[model samples]
Target chain A: MDGLKKHIEEITPITNEEFDYIKTFFKEKKVKKHQYLLQDGDKVTSEYWIVKGIFRAFHIDKDGKEHILQFALENWWFSDYNAFFSQKESNINIVCMDDAEVLCLTLSGREQLASEFHKMEHFFRMKLTSGYSAQQRRIISLLSNNPKKRYEEFASLYPNIMQKIPKKYIAEYLGVSRETLSRLYSTTSRD
Target chain B: MDGLKKHIEEITPITNEEFDYIKTFFKEKKVKKHQYLLQDGDKVTSEYWIVKGIFRAFHIDKDGKEHILQFALENWWFSDYNAFFSQKESNINIVCMDDAEVLCLTLSGREQLASEFHKMEHFFRMKLTSGYSAQQRRIISLLSNNPKKRYEEFASLYPNIMQKIPKKYIAEYLGVSRETLSRLYSTTSRD
Candidate 1:
């Protein structure tokens, strides 16, 4: 609850009345490791904010290999964003990497909140802007950086993530082969 | 100016005063084929809306190969978005694919518009949402779809783009080799 309060405060100052209204829409859920919050083809009706533990959102490639798109830890949010916003069936699956607690908000609830609070709308808009900019940076990194540099940057950017996830998953996210990642790691270790 | 008016109207209604303020900030510029609107390491102060011909945003890989990140045609906008928003040096390059005419807006001008006109901010927010959704879809497509299917979908989605740009550039954007694209084109042509 403290984490949720802090997250909300970072976005906008929520009035107690507005906070109460928003609170009615959110339900807390606990998920065990390997349990799925969402699966491909599901209608993504809710977005989840992490209260505890680790979660990942990933897609299966044509060869049925999982490509991790995002890893969410405490105070972060995770969802099939494309499906949630577009009202389309999800192409991504979200699974808990460890025992987790999450706060969930349904799409309708979010829309209601936005309509009721202009400040909330502004907060969401800012969030989307930063998210969009980050995505743009990811694309540029994919284009400009070699696998080695990307791996180094990844480790530096999310030091905890490297310890929690497999190297293969990181390779997939970086658009490199596991073999390449292994070679890079060996070379870096030697250096 | 007419295209700009139409583009803005499609997003939101702007008053004469608001329109005048926006118009004052934009300067029309003509770029020769293969010329750059922005280059890597340069500060990206402005974004351009294409009025004629074609422009592309790309990055050079370690192997010195170009990867097309996006293309802009008539009525479309192009920028080193990461640089524009963050006020950092650009990692992406914006190059003219053909003799091009564009209307440009600086970062300060855009901020002014957002601060002065709530409608303008709403319009930009909507654009950002749609763009973010599209990027998510592209990521999914890259992960799930074969080169042939990707090309087919792109052709269907942007028929005008297919006719305007070279196949090689499209192949780069799809993260496929030109030879693979040629094979796909032959199969599609037969069908």
Candidate 2:
């Protein structure tokens, strides 16, 4: 809850009373490594804010190949947003990569908080603005079709996550082969 | 102004007085075909909401190959958002594909408007939510790397834009070769 207050204050400040009220909307959940936070076809009711540990969100195609959508680390937010916002069944799964704790906020709760406090609305908007920009950058990286450049961009953008995520998953996220990512990793390490 | 009001109302309604005040933050501009709205290295001071015609936003690689980032049609917002929000120099170029009109809003203007009215903040947040979701969908599409699926997804998602944009640009946007797109287009046309 302290972390949640800190996260919100990072964008906009709120009084202790406001914080206490806002904290009521969130419920803390603990998850073990390899456990699922969300699975395909489940109705997405809440978006989680990571309090500790890591998670991976991915989609499985008809051929059984998994396409990594995103990786969320501590203090980051994670959800099948399309489903969460629409209150529809999720097409992706979010699985814990490490033993973790997260604070879950339902859509109605989120809307209520935002509508209740202009600062909360501003905070959420700021977070979404950065998320939107990062996604745009990813789109450009993917469109360029330069594996080396993409790997570099990802590493630079999330240096901490770069060190923590498995190389195979990193390869999948970059849309490159494991062998290619291995080569890049070795070359990068040497450099 | 009507379109701008309508766009904002699509998410949240506003009083006429509020709309009048909100409209003051934007200035209208007209652009000619083949003209640039934004160019690489230029400081991005504003984001534009298209009122008429089409535009293409792209990045040029070291090899001078153009990688299409996105296409903007009427009602779509366009900007080197990475630069616009940060008030930094742009890394991409936005060129008008047809004679166009747009309403421009500065960063300060946007921030002030959001802070001045809770409904405006909610409106912007809702817009960003949809934009963020769209970008996430795009990342999954790009990572999948199936040109046929990508083409179909793009066509189905934006049938109007598909018909309006040239094949070459569409191929670039899908990260497929022009020839591959031609084959897909012919097959789809026949079907």
Candidate 3:
């Protein structure tokens, strides 16, 4: 709860009463390693905030190859954002990588919070702006940078993530292959 | 100005007086084919609303290969969005695909409108939500769909874009090669 408090405070000032109101909408849940938080075809009605451990949202292709879209560690929020917001069935699956604790808020609850609190709306808008900005950077990086450079950047930016996730998942996220990633890793080692 | 009126009305109801006030801040410009409205290293201070013709936002890689990010036709708005909101120099280039007419509005002008009009802020939020939703779809499509499916989907969504842009640019946008796109086109024709 301290992490959630700190994150919200960083964006906007929230009164104790306001925080209490907001907190009521979020339900705490514990998930075990290798357990599924969400699976394809399920409706993603809720967004989860990581309080501890790791979780990944991924899509499996026709050939059953998994492409990791996002990895959420402590203090980060994760959801099948498309399905959650659009009220559609999820096309992605979210799996816990480690035993995890999460604070989950339903879409309706979030909307209620936004309508009831102007500052909450501002906080969310700010979050969306920052999310979009980072996504814009990622898109550019994907288009402009080579696989090696992208791998290096990713390692530096999310060092813990790099250590935790499988190499294959990283390759898929970077739009490369396991063989290619291995070659790049060896090339970087030589340097 | 009729185009601007229609565009704003579609987003939110604004009176003629409010429209006129908004109109004063916009500078109308005509761009010749292949000319740039913006380029890499330039500061993106304004967002452009297309009155006529087509525009593309793209980034050129180190190898000087162009990757198309988006296409804007008449009634659509275009900008180096990452640069526009962040007050940063743009890495993306906005090029006119045909002789184009556009009305450009500065960030400050938009901010002023939002401050003065509550409706305008609500309107902007609605637009942002839809834009974010579309972006989420694109990201999911990129990760989940094959190149052929992506091409078909893009064609159906923006048929005009498919007709106007070069195949290579489409290929780059799909993260496919020119050769692969050629193969896909032939296969589709045969079917």
List clashing residue pairs in candidate 2: none
Q: Write the per-residue lDDT of candidate 2 for residues B1-191, one digit (tens) a residue.
A: 89889988888989999998999999999999999999999999999999998999999876788988778889888799878888999989999999999999999999999999999999889988888877777777777667777787788657767668888789878887889988988898788
Q: Write the per-residue lDDT of candidate 2 for residues A116-171, one digit (tens) a residue.
A: 99999999999999888888777877777788878887887677676688888898
Cα lDDT of model 3 by residue, A1-191, tens digit:
76787788997888887787789999999999999999999988898889998888888877777777767788777788767888889988999989999999998898777657766665666666655665666666666767876777566546757678888777877888799988887887788
Q: How far is B184's C-alpha from truth in model 3 (Å)?
A: 5.4
In model 2, which regions exceed 4 Å deviation? A177-191, B177-191
C-alpha lDDT score of every prediction, in listed order: 0.78, 0.88, 0.78
Docking class of 1: medium
Worst 10 residues of 3 chain B by lDDT: B118-127
Screening candidate 3 with a backbone cut-off below 3 angstroms (N, C-alpha, C), the clashing residue pairs are: none
Contacts from the true interface found in each model, as a fraction, amount to 0.44, 0.69, 0.25
* Cα distance off (Å), candidate 2, residue A143: 1.1
Please rank every candidate by DockQ, starting with the best. Answer: 2, 1, 3
Candidate 1 C-alpha lDDT tens digits along A101-159: 99998878876666566666566667777777766766666556577767775665466
**Highest DockQ, which number?**
2
- Candidate 1: RMSD to truth: 3.0
